[model samples]
Structure formats: structure tokens, C-alpha cells
Target: MTNFEEDISVYNFVSILGECFQNKASVNLVKHYPTGRMLAVKRFHLDKIWDNISIVQQEITLTKQLQHPNIITYYTSFVHGPEVFAVSPLQAFGSCKSLLDSHFNEGLPELAIILIFKDIIEAVNYLHKSGFIHRAIRASHILISASGKASLSGLHYACPLVINGRWQRAVHSFPLSTQPNLNWLSPELLEQNLKGYNEKSDIYSLGILCCELANGREPFADVDSTLMLVEKVRGCIPGLLDCTTLPSKCDDRECQGDCDIEISLSRRGFSQYLHEFCYMCLEREAKDRPSAAELLTHPVFTLVNKGISLPELLKPVLPLSDKVSPNKEMCHLDHVLHMSEMDMPSCDWDFPIS
Candidate 1:
């Protein structure tokens, strides 16, 4: 019997539900036959793992050690012949990127953005405390739940940001075979370096992600990766808020009057604070950037009204995703533009590497 069949026979797991990320890992919808508790079983084929066995083992090791409210829960994992299976609570709402594509195309509301980032910041802070850096932080890596809670995902690129309990600079020599989303990489990480980068690099990527959430797209996604690297090293920042629109009172699509102009001016001020928040995240100096813990308490996050829940914002659009196929081509080019055409085991998870 195949590894998958053996796992099913031993664990009594249900069938596959969906597949996501560039890795093509199957997200299986399973249930504990005894208790009927639902689960998301992620199956990674061992044959495909090949030489990356150590990385996969590390991913499982690191995931097992993490426990945070904003981080996805890693229930358990086991090897069944040639396959490894990780089980966690299924996020029915899918990824934040899928939400953006299906709904909220104009960008999330300021309050919603603040709440989501606050959760993400808390998760990143926890990771830093554990002495690791989530090298890749992006909208696609942030998964949302039916309850509207946002958790950080994509831990495959995770590595030690500190050594012997001391924060240290580490450099990575990117392999020509693999292409990453260069826009999210901090300037220091993109440079030819011997000193390398640290947890602060994750902070830089967080800043870019904030802009992405506010604008409903990855920043500088249209530029070629090589050119992006040069621009980043030159202290160029992504124009995250430049394209954002202010909340308007006009019910109609088209309106022209002194009242409309007055309304525009009044509403423009609403996003000013959010713009400043993004600016704080996009600071050119990594040292100048606030730590994840510090950013959690920023004034911008205070804008989230306790009375309003993020689920309300996601309710309308979440159901729309059920009708669409995950493999269906995204109509928006900007959403997937940063993703390379190459085929490799893509990794991004709030819990274990996906």
C-alpha cells in the first residue's frame, strides 16, 4: 500500500480537501473517527523531499516547540512509510491573500488592518523571543479564520536569528535555483554580505506586509526581482499608501461637486494615521524600525474599536471563496506577480512549514 493509504488505515483520517501554496502540498480534511473532531492534515511526500530532509525535520521540530494564541496550533505529526503528515485545525476561511482576491479588493478598512497586524506582530514577537526569524512575511503567509482571527503562517524559511542567546547578524547566499519574493526581503538581506541579517529583518518585512494589507496588494510587485534588490539597497521604500483611497460618503460611483471635494478632504485625514503607521514600518534604517513588541502598542492599533469584529468584514467575502476553485487563475496579476514560475516545495505556515 502507498504511504497515504497506510496513514489512512492507521489513523482513520478523511480524504483530501484542498491544495495550496506553490509546494502543492495537500491540505486534507480529516476527522478523528472516534471523537469526530475536525482537522487539517497536511501531507508532504517524502520522495519529493529528497535532499531537503534536514529542513523538513527542522520544520517539524520548530513547529512542535511553538505555542502562541496568534500562531496556528500544531496538533501532531507522524511518518507513515514515505509520507509525513501534520495535523492542525483547518482554517476554513483560507489565506489572507485568497480573501483579498475574493473580497475587499479596494483594501481592508483601517480598523481591520490594525487588528490583523496586531495579531501578526504578537506572533512575530513570540518567534523573536524564541530566537528565530520568519524570513518571509507576506499577506499570503497570513491565514484568516472563520472567526476573523489572523495568524502568521509560512515558517519554512524560519531560522535562528540569534546564536548562543545573542542576537547575531547572519547572511544568506541565495541559490540561483530558487527565486523568492524579493520585495518583502529587507535591504540588508538582499545585499552581498558577510555579516548577514537578524530578527530586525522580519520587522522590515512586517512593514511591507502592513502596506500590502492597507493597499490590497504586495508593494513593488511589478518590478523585476533583481531591480527590486538594487532599489531596496538604495533606500527606496515601497509606495504602500500612495494608492490608497479614503473612505467616501458618496453612494454613487461617480460624483462631482463642492460637497464631494469637501467630503474627500475630510475623509483623507482618516487614513493619515494609518499612513504614518506604514511609514514607521517602512523605515529605511532597520535599527530605526520598532521591534514587533513595540509596534503592537502603536497608536494606530488603538484605532480598532472593540465593538467591531473583523469577522463582520470577512463574512461577505468568505463564502464567495467556496464557489471558486483554488487552482483557478487569479484575475489580478499583482497578487501572484511576486511568485516565481519555478516548481519547488514552497513553505509558509503560521504553525509548521507548509
Candidate 2:
């Protein structure tokens, strides 16, 4: 067996839940003592703890503040000497990566692809509405739960907003690392020309994640980080090798102008609506990209067949007694303003209700 499997055995783990990309952490499915309930333990080594403390803190803070079914639920956190750990519900199917790897050969059915993308977009829209930007969005960071639901994980790089009048900038202390995964970074981030990454960066990463989901491969799997950086600077978008066959003259060229032809051809599996969403997300100019709220209202998510507005589809039908209290509404608005300021947006929304 491999060293990883040996390590898993040593940990007395029931199963290896998932492997992280940077080797910074690992998630294991283990039986909790006494209760014997299954749980996911995210273990980060002591050596990387100092560098990752902010990340752990961010995860804790963000999870506590944002409550959504599609977002990964944080059960608890603990510290054992230099090592820090966070426990969440175990996902039986592992990550989106595992699913793609196992099913790629057979190809993903259209219904399955639609379901996955819908889940991911919902999670992302929730984060955006809550005033958080998930800087690291990739296939590995998305978990497929036992109930066949997709949940987003990893918020170490998430930026909280701090609103100052009509302007926003990311919280000052949570510094951007010199080395970030360039493969999934947007063009503005690669050039370091962008002052702050707002919701749009998350959108760009989502586009890459969509590419991975449809093709069963990482968007730029073969390219090294440096080359990926170079390619991104030259406006070279990544393409997919595997795609579902479509009828002739499908006109999948909806997202054509954003990148080189190679990238466009690879995205044939995506519908025109999905293509447009990805294109808006991958826009080189941040201002050109759609907001999370806007994305939630897109035709891909709208209940067009039923003639229902996007908001109507997302509206909760709870009884009046369970409606949001005035105090809670104020708190949520305050949080949104704070987030908008940190994002450094030109204007902030002043809700009429407030």
C-alpha cells in the first residue's frame, strides 16, 4: 500500500475522505469515539499551521456567519499542540474530483451535469449574498455528500467585506500570498494589476470549475503553474478534452470572444446559457463580470419553463412566525455593507427596507 494509505491506517481512520491539492491538509472519515458517529476530520500539519491559521479562522468565521444547505457545514474545531483541525460531516462520494475521475470514461449525462452546476452556483450565490468571496474554488474544494448533494468547502482565502461609505477593500491583515494556484486565478489576479478581487474572481474560478465538471478533467491539467500564468497573461483559456456529443449546428460558440479558439472548442458540452455565464465570469475586466445576485437571476437558473422569477424560486415559504426579525435583518444588511466596502466596489446597495 502507499504511504498515504499507511498513514490513514495509523490514524485509525475508517476511510480517507479526500486529498487536498497543495498537500497542506487531508480529510479523513473516522468514527467518533463512544458515539461512533462518522465525521470528516480535516487535518493540517503543525508545520503549516502558522501559515494557515488565518485560513482556519476564516473558515470558522465564515461558516458561523453564513448558513446555507449547499455550503459545507462546520461541526467543530480543535487544536492539538501545533496542529489545527476542523471537523465537518463526512462526504461519502469524496469530492467532485473523485466523481469525475471515476465517471469520466463513461461521460457525464446532461441531467447530472445540470444538477451539479446548479448546486455549485447556488452555493456560490449564497456566499456572494453573504458578502464573502471564496478565493479558492476548484473541483477538490467541492464535496459530494452522502445524500447526493454538493457542498462547498475551504474558506481560508475567503475575503470579508468592510464597507466605508460607497467603497470597499478586503480586510487588511488577511494578506494575499505571493504564490497562489495560477491555474484557476483570473487574468487580473495573474497580472497583479487588480487592486482587489471582488465577487468576479469567484465567478472566474467557478467557470474553471464548470470546465472541470463538464470535461472530467482539470481545466489546465497538463500545464505547469508558470506556463499557466504565461498563458493566462496572453489570454489563453483552457479547454476540455472530453465532452458530450451534440447535435450538428449547436452553435456552442456563445463564449467565443473571451479566449483562444482552443478553449472555446473544448467547452462544447456547455449549453448557451452556461456558456454565457462562464464567459461573463471569465471577463478580463472585472467590471464587465456579473454579480452573484445577477448570476442567480440568469436564465440558466431561472424557472423559465414555469415562468417563475429567480427570486421566487429561491424564496423561502416558511410561516410568518419564522420570518427574519428586524434585528437580524439589520445585522445582515450591516454585514453586506461591510463586505461591499472590503471588496472596494464603487458603490454599495442601500436597500429600501433598511
Alpha carbon lDDT of each predicted model? 0.66, 0.56
lDDT of 1 by residue, 312-341 (tens): 766665532244343443333223222323
The runs of at least 3 residues in candidate 1 whose Cα sits more than 4 Å from the true structure, single-residue gaps closed, are: 1-17, 164-166, 169-178, 242-270, 319-352
lDDT tens string, model 2, 1-354? 111221222233443333342445555445554344556666666675566566567667777677888888766666655455666666655566555555442234434555566777798888876777777777767766555567777666676655653435433332365343456767666666537556677778877876666665556667788777777778775533323332223455675453333453445565566666666777676788777667767776542343422223212322122332433322222343243224232111100000
Estimate the TM-score of every prediction: 0.78, 0.66
State in Å the error of residue 290, model 2. 1.7
Clashing pairs for model 1 are 152-350, 153-349, 153-350, 154-348, 154-349, 155-349, 170-196, 171-196
Supply the TM-score for candidate 2.
Answer: 0.66
